[model samples]
Target: MILDDFLIYNTNGLYCKCGDFYLDPQVPVTHAVISHAHADHAVASNNEVYCTEATAAFMQLRYAKNAAKVFNIAAYHQSFVVGGVAVTFISAGHMLGSAQVLMEYQGTKYLYTGDYKIQPDATCEPIEWAKADVLITESTFADPEVLHPDPVVEIKKLNDISLNIMLGAYSLGKSQRLINLITEHAPQKTILVHHRIMPINQVYERMGYKPGKYQIYGRKLMKQQGGFVYIVPPFTFDSYARAKDVKRLFASGWKNLQVNKQDTLFISDHADWNDILEAVKQVQPSQIWTLHGDGRHLKNHFNNDIFVKLLS
Candidate 1:
């Protein structure tokens, strides 16, 4: 579908717009606006790119030279114009530097939400809902059957489960979210983190989220903490016997589903079905386009007035 003179294509990339930009003629447009630095969402090769400052730093570290052309914008609501499109950015709450891009052309406003999560987390700002004419959103956890436990409740459960319990999650976003939740809900207890999580923890700290006493993964540190919560990657759980002394919990958006029998905990960064409904009601957009994950399931739950398109 076309909006005004802008042409939207379901290219082999996350989200691409083709118009009056000249940098990457091979792709679609010159001014590429990105939602986050996730490998699938943002490509550093794009000549002129726009994303949050933290995302830019991450891209710079990953693809040094390619990141030089990036234009960094702070996560706090900010507006800028590119190619005659008045674009404003807000936090997506998915990662340290994730953002939702809102573009206004003439009088119509179009909002593109890059993978977002409504549940509050310490790793990033809470997702911000905005009203718009066209709302493009992510449906990563759109099924009603998927329901995440309340952050506070989950933290209490995790705390009471065992002293030497190890939680498995992604090193970047999920780790910080779990750590922050534990800090807020169970501040008295010192948390232990794996060495891989240290870098992202530093980034989160720079973003003003200071976690409580934590220890990085090492033989010496692991031996010292027999009753502390150790946050590690999901892959670590494959060799459960290695951590036999500690109980294990797997945290992810997928945990909301009953597909697995393993001890799964529902702690996700993505918005669940309830979050999607509320966000749609809050935004009240005339048109809604769903992207990523199961969009059709979410589309069926909304009102008929809102146009829904699945961008697979």
Candidate 2:
């Protein structure tokens, strides 16, 4: 469907095209409005980007020299005119500076929710529901059976398994959530983080979020503690031969599938089935378009008015 003069296409990533305006340039969109700095959600090829300041900094660090015009929009509800369309951003609560985009054109309002979670997290602002004529959302954990343990309870259990257990997750969003959870519940425990995640951790700290005491991974740090919680990117396990002695736990919605326990965990940054239903009820959008992960399964349980589309 066309909104204003923009053409909307569901690209492989969390990207949408409106005429020459694209929200994310994972592929190729003239104008991109990024929801966050996740690698999959934001690509450097896009010429123009509209996102929160945190996301812009992240993109710049990773995709240096990319001639992308980035416009910083605060996490609060604020509107900007892009290509004659009014666009606004609201908190998504998935990570620091994550936002949900609201686009209005020709009196029609459309809300696009990037990866989001309704549960209140201390590390980030809570997700805010906004009224929209068409709402696009993520259904990462759409199945009712795919419920996640409470953040507090799960972190404790994870800590109990092994004080030195290394959690495997995306270095950006999931890692921050795990850090905050550990700090709030297991503040006494020393948290070790990978070198790649250290930079982002600093940003989180600057935002006034207490991330607990953490050290960068190295021989000296590793030898100092035998039972400390460590957070690392999922790719770390690819070279598990070096980490054979360390117990590794994977965390993501992909863990819900009956896969190898060593491969994934049920901890996800996105809202699960219960959270999705609650969000839909709270937002009460006229129509729903699901994106990311297993959206079809989640849409089956909802009314026909809710439209389900997979992220191509």
Candidate 3:
């Protein structure tokens, strides 16, 4: 097992004792190296934060009351040293400004893949890989047989159906990705999204990752364009009075989603088992640490040859 104590001092999030910083810490700290804008990974009330430019902007939008006291912007592949530890950010392909953090100290290199996907996405940066002595990865979809279906197939489901569709998705990364997918694959359908998703979309556009055509959610627009596709945040979907003719569908890859046959669009933004394996092959890490989901599948799959540790 050979765990390097100095590189990872796991208390709150993945803390780096050498750097005196936390990677995506849940509890606020003096210095936090954030991975992305997702609510869970990017938290509020930190003395100083280091993340990609888009992630910093997203933090301000998401946590207005207690945003990061200081935003240290780091572009992709940008390397900087913190307390003698070399650090760099790699495109994580999870969402806008999502990144894989690389840290090197005392001749040992480590990479923490914070919620990533290899499958090409239209709305954000593409995934990039590099070798590391140790790799900390997410096991969101760790089951070997749980390979995700092509997202385009899910978008086509809406195109194939004739009824007005009310698609429920998370407002941040998933919404923007879905809009671009639908527009690029099913261009014939008019797409309308919730008010919450508009500003994030604008951020993506400013970063030059513009999504396809979509208007903010409006009852008048839906009435004018009879069968327009309405995309709303999962929580707010019910608040909007459902039109009699509209079919409701929730987009996610979770198996529980299938319980209700009526409304489950199997689309996801996180990496599946196959993507995880590919990342492992690319990084070729001496040791692998998993988190964020049931990591049994990944640990079992690579049991014989590779060192797989479950970091609860």
Candidate 4:
């Protein structure tokens, strides 16, 4: 393994000195190589932003004229030069236009996986594997015991319940995925999405992703007794916390989010333990650098087999 730290994490997120750019920077920077359009990763007002086409669109939709001074959009696998480094974007499969940033400088390859998942997602691009010398990964669900159940089976749980369900999900990625899953698995429940989520859904549809059938949310639906699914953002979901008529279910992989709620739908857009292991195998990296979540489990698992460095 190379002795040099190809990438480093600080308050500004992942930085590449060779490239003179930040990878999914927390704060706005002069040159930002965004991995996706997620709020945390793709902040507005960057001088020059580099990302995929879909990511650009989402950013434009969210931040409007403030998205960036210049959008250097690149397709998946296309290599572009930023200072001394050659950068490439690979599909991350977490959400639409999400990518794993691959930076190559002085013969060494470093891959920064920004919120990736290996699970099949119809709403976004599938994760692509590329061999790299150093693998910078997210350890969100790195614990060995945190294996996520099959999403198909999890979504099917909605079919068993015939009540009006207030389903809470993130508007950007999770909501779209849930709509598709419900259409395929729980066809009996009519889909009602919040008005705020409609623009994003339209973006998904225009991008050629069919998220099945869903209508804009209406207050009248809440008066109904059964047979519908009201999909809303977290804020709206929390607002209806006291509504006693509908069954509450939040789709997420985090246990903390599922706490105090009996109806659990364990759906995640991040890689679980086994998926992380598989990503390591696919990347074929000699050195591993973890961030975003706890990396102690990975450090213990790799032990002497591979070098595991926690960036967080």
Best by lDDT, which number?
Answer: 4
**Residue 280, candidate 1: how far off, in angstroms?**
1.0
Q: How many pairs of residues collide in model 1?
A: 0
Which segments of model 2 are wrong by more than 4 Å?
A: 1-7, 10-19, 72-75, 256-265, 304-312
lDDT of 4 by residue, 152-223 (tens): 999998887767888999999999999999998888889999999999999999999979889988888767
C-alpha TM-scores of all predictions: 0.84, 0.86, 0.94, 0.97
Which is better, 1 or 2, measured by lDDT? 2
The deviation in Å at residue 275 for candidate 3 is 0.8
Question: What is the per-residue lDDT of model 3 for residues 1-312, given as tens digits with 9 covering 90 to 100?
Answer: 334564454557777887889989988899899999898999899999999999998999889869888989999999988777889999999998999999887778899999998878988889999899888998888887888998887778777777778888888999888888888888888999888889888888888988889998777776653458888886777565454667777788886644247546888888898888899899999888887888888777878788888776
The best-first sequence of candidates by TM-score reads: 4, 3, 2, 1
lDDT of prediction 4: 0.91
Give the residue spans of candidate 4 off by over 4 A.
Answer: 1-3, 259-261
Q: Could you tell me how far off, in angstroms, the CA of residue 30 lies in candidate 1 after the best superposition?
A: 5.0
What C-alpha lDDT does candidate 2 achieve relative to the native structure?
Answer: 0.71
Worst 10 residues of 1 by lDDT: 19-28
Clashing pairs for predicted structure model 2, backbone only:
6-18, 6-19, 7-17, 7-18, 7-19, 12-312, 22-31, 22-32, 23-33
Candidate number that wins on lDDT, 2 or 3:
3
User: Candidate 4 at 156: error in angstroms?
Assistant: 0.9
Give the distance in Å from residue 287's predicted Cα in candidate 3 to where it truly belongs.
0.6
CA RMSD, predictions in order? 3.6, 3.2, 2.0, 1.2
Q: Give the per-residue lDDT of model 2 (tens digit) for 1-312.
A: 424323345543443343346665558456778888888788876766788887887777777778366555555677887877788998888887889888887777788888888777877778888888767777767788888776676666654544356677788877888887777777766778889999888887887765566788765655554567678776775556356456667766664432345434466678888888887787777677766667767567764766544543
